[model samples]
Target: MTTHDLPRLRPEVVLGPALRTGPKTVHHIKDESTGCFYRVGPREHFIMGLMDGRHTLQDIGVQYRETYDRTLGPDSWQQMFTLLGRYQLLDGHADAGVLDRFRQAQQDKQAARQGWLRRRWVLLQPDRLCATLAARLGFAFRTGFVVPALALIALLQTIVWTHTTVLAHDASHQRSWAVAVPLLLVLGWLITMLHELAHGVTCRHFGGSVTEIGLSWRFPLLTPYCRTDDIVLFHRRRARVGTAFAGVFVGLLSLAPVTLWWWLTRDGGPGHRIAAALLLFGSAGSLMSLLPFLRSDGYVMLTHALGLVDLRRESYRFWRLRLRRRDPAARDTLRAYPSGDVRAYTLYGIATLAVAVPAYCALMWVWFARLRHWTGPGWAVVVLAAETLVVAGLLLGAARGRRADRQAADA
Candidate 1:
């Protein structure tokens, strides 16, 4: 706090190359030691820049007053230094225990996960060697690659859809669930990896580095996802949107080979059966992601499009506000956003949940009935009831998991 006390920024802390988003010029603060990235606006960047060995804290405050015509408060100074120190962005001298607190926070996070979710196992990263492989594959994001891909997908889908029949049937048509189940599971796992890869590669193509490639649990369901927090630094909406739904696009593209092979082989053959199972599961899962009510790719895309991060929560509050006759106690958070966003949230929020639930239940029922090869109407009804209960249980598990996560954080 003394005028003579000159604090130095850590040599390893690197400011970004100055990205422009909207009206502000911001930089991504990257700590080379921790591999941590944090976003800061121009003013915050100025504060950090002034942390050179020459300028003391008092001098930095004077500089801030000169620049903004107002004295910088102690709270601002505390927050900035606390963050910088927590991330180890400052040199030898900072609040002595901030780094310790940061380490404790990380340890607490690790301790919070109880039984089945203690750790995530990362499967593979093809680009670990030759890191520039993704950069070279940037052409894949362009129309030249996409248009041909789309054409091929259409051709393969057409093959699966129409004019196909069983020709030379195998004698071993006794439904091999034992072999098929394991094989299908492995195939699905790889497909999930492919989905995450699509996101990572798309992000790299759009000039963001892939931080981690791994598998993580989505509530009770184990799903694969990639971390590209660098997307926050990506100023363009197109880049962010492309990164968001890249998995969904890859899911769609994968159908080409599965559908084509299914058509080429005999209907009763193992290849046909495996392909059918994958197609069913992949299609259903991707469709589920498209439900805007749920937190999936489609919802992410919609949220980014609407330019509202809290669309679902705010929209619910808006509706609640209306239902209670504009009660002052209820938060009308959506009112601050643009009129377009308000309307979009209002329509998408309620309508998506209302329609998607039954629609999902119907899809599941049909899928189960098809798998069982149920012939009678009574069997179909039973399948519907079973599928509905399964969906409900999964939903309840997700809700409980979310609550647990929040409680852990609070604790």
Candidate 2:
């Protein structure tokens, strides 16, 4: 606790990739003993590096000032020491209670890893095989090859689009709502794995590592997720954007053949039937995923492309200031962002809202109409009220986010 006392990080702590967290840069620190990652900013990195046990706090602070031309303030020293001690990053000569908590965290992570082995690792062998195959075929993903490949893919997509413009009006779609909806979601999930695979492959091809490629849940809905967080390090914006939209582009392109077959041979086989259903549902998934409002592949792609993080939240703050408030400080805060980010955020916000408004209304109407026969007028009322509540909640969230942005800027 005193400047005379030397502190050291435990041997089991490791640092991973660094990424832009809003305007700040942060690195991913993994506690080897616990198998979990924590994001820490530049100041924390300086503190962690100094905890080599060779230097006392006073010496470390002096070194930090010399190197960074800024004081390692007394308050930050206390806070950082507490954090390191809590995570058992400090040498294990701290309070017994702190070490006990750290031990419990490690035990909990081991338990979770065991559960992952039982459920996820069993299926992970196939995923690893696919990744190996992809890496071997990595040459095919190069821009020169992918450009022609996408041209062929686009032609196939055009064939289906022109032929199946009236697919919604088809007699095959005139079935029980119960059957179609679930089939759509199920098929969408399976097909979108390939989309995620494309992201992983494109990411790997661009010199980034694939950290995860497995099933991930979003509350009540379960879907496959592929992570390429390391893609942020790419110097080229094209590489990052390509990796981001790789999933959506690959998804739609892969389904083009199925869509064409579904359209061509109306009374096709069960494969055709399933493919047609998937094309319908998966198209929705693709469109939704492209929306910059959420953490879709597109969102992450656009964010990293602009060398910023949390663009959606930051964009929302900008909009809130321009549209609602009149805070000069907030205006200055928004202006502090790079001009490229400011322009991109504005354009993205406008495009998202234009598409999202119509999409949200249509989606809600479909839900109400599909369920109205069973639940009747009372049900319609309930659905409308629910929609209103959801919108209200979103507005409240935006307001809270704006306030949080102000607080962060102040800090």
Candidate 3:
């Protein structure tokens, strides 16, 4: 069976009694004598090994052999126990009886999902899976799809990645990808350079300097950014809306080349098709850049258009407040609030839900159904349902949150 087939160990119960925590719940654990709390995952296991403080380095080695059936080689059990003791979960040669009950609880819990975790852990490395797929599919055949599909994928990836990085992040900060104008210009294509430029132009039209633009790493990724942090200090609605929509405007501008080419070569061959495909790719990518859930240009526009800095945060708070039987009005207003511009946010959510759910489902269905062959109506019903559910869910959730906020304020 695939590693994904393995049962998942409940994260809440992974530590058990030695956990100093409870089942199906997250709780704090501390050693009464040492006064050290084990807050993280592996540290808990390491701490448990040191409960029997009398176990010598050699004794612990022997215990590992007896229990886990292993020799204490490099990075041995003695070392682990010693490390645990140092972390203050154990006192050297201190009382051991207190831990006996905790130890038994841990051992019982360990047996609950041992094999499942091991298998699932093996499956979690996506790079390895991609490597395997590459080996099986062969790099040459994969490239065959590139002629028509790669451009679209590139557009989508670039759009989403750029939006998440540039317009949504860097532009908000009033920065650019780099100091050099040429590098800045190149970055505009890939890093929301044009998007930010559109913002700068709009701002200049309203009398403002195009500040700095540069690059930064946002952990697990690198991106070009345009800093417009200054304008927000002014609190100008027109500027906010313009800056928020700059990237989208740029994306729209990009459509011109493709649209022109497609129109000019409506009766042409591979060249026309390639141009059309590139257009579709860029268009799709630009649209993805506007997805609100992921903090893209669309998200930025929604935030500014709605005059809310933390709309997602508000949505999450509203959701939580619902569970707690509390009002969400104060929470919604805690961030910036739009004055009767709710439609922008509503449409943004609707558009995203409409596109993302169907696209995601369709992709999944296609992936599964295409395991044996290339073409047919595959897993269509699932795709349609997924799409409808996503759209409905977003619409309902947004409406509910707004209603809750209004009710809370009224009360």
Candidate 4:
């Protein structure tokens, strides 16, 4: 179509919330028909926002010039149209070639689900349940209630911290490992379920959808997961951030009563011991979920707050290119992104490595210490060496996978 032609977005395509990072504002657009999401900058968002079957490309170009003091040439118009058509975001019927490519992509995705590690079992569809819960308990999401709840959680955590030594002693002194171990496992699993449910319910409370509740196994652990994919479509940053923080908030809040029980009861009593164990383990787990290095609640919250998409991947790519600064192509690619984004990527990459490297080292040290205590120093060293080799191999494999992904994207 020419600049004189009107362009319209498909009815099924939904625009997401505005995410402001420094001087840049990014917007997410989702195609409900294909369940695909795309991130666009302010200029693109402005153009797309006016695509209501009434705005001609020429009209949009004039407005864009007035707004941004920039002109869109024929090449830019062509590129925009190509992007819209490729994503099936246009209102009219797509070309046969585009339809064929889309179908092939879908088929490829379906055909690639052959690995056990990538398999997931959907336990139930929780959309209706989450909707009902959200409707009934919507008041809990209000600022009036949330603020007080957060304050109380902070107070409880402070108390737990103050009495940490006593709680640890009480929990450790419990002689029934067999019983306590199983109870702790069950309690931890239950807490995780509530954590995932909190995300689903809060998403629904904020005009999002929770479609699937499922189980996925990740090597040593099997965990419950809830799909709140619709959070990406929220129009408010507060709603998106709140949804990300909901699980961590609920997980910690759920431990309040147990914390109180541990505090109030006789120190060595069964109730006090059980409460101490649950409070200590549950609180540790909840807090750990806030470590930004992991793809956990904190990472999601940080990304939403910063209004950045694929922060980890982008940050890694930025650092990789940065280390190859002598390469003209790498330097040019780095210069292509906004200065704000480049600064963000640099800061995030540095911070991630700063925190993650030490954390990994500490974890390895702890593992070796525990093994030494159990199997003597020589065996501990042997086992640690073997584990180190395994981890190195895994890291290499991941690097190769990323290289393949980059090549595929480039292709």
TM-score on alpha carbons, each prediction: 0.64, 0.62, 0.36, 0.83
Candidate 1, lDDT over the whole model: 0.67
lDDT string for model 3 (1-411, tens) is 321122121121212221111111122334433222234443334334344434454555566567666676756545654644443343333335645554554445433333311211121212233334334534323346534444654554455445443323322332232332344345336536555555545444433334445443432235445544333322466566666666565565655555565456655533344444445445666666666765566666666555554455455543344355444654544334333434344454456568778987777666657543533355455555566687677667655655664464334
> Model 4: how far is 239 from its true place, Å?
2.3
The lDDT values for all models are: 0.67, 0.67, 0.46, 0.79
Candidate 1 lDDT over 1-411, as tens digits, reads: 542278778876666535432223457776544455566787888888888889988889999989988787879888887766556777875443765565566546645654453345566554452246576776877899988987876665455444333211221232687887888889887787778888888777766667567666754566566776666555577777788888877877887787777666754555777777676667667767766754677777776665554456556656666577565544343344456755775687679678977887678766776766655766766767786788688767755775687566445
lDDT per residue for candidate 4 within 311-403, as digits (tens), equals 787787778788999999988877777887888888888898899799878988999889998999899989988988987776666566657
Residue-wise C-alpha lDDT for candidate 2, range 328-388, written one tens digit per residue: 7767666566566668768878987898899888887877887788789687869778877
List ranges where model 1 is wrong by over 4 Å: 1-104, 110-133, 158-178, 207-215, 218-220, 266-270, 310-325, 329-334, 356-411
All candidates: CA RMSD (Å): 6.8, 7.3, 22.2, 3.9
**Count of backbone collisions in candidate 3:** 20
Count of clashes in candidate 2: 0
Best-matching candidate per TM-score: 4
Cα lDDT, model 2, residue 122: 19
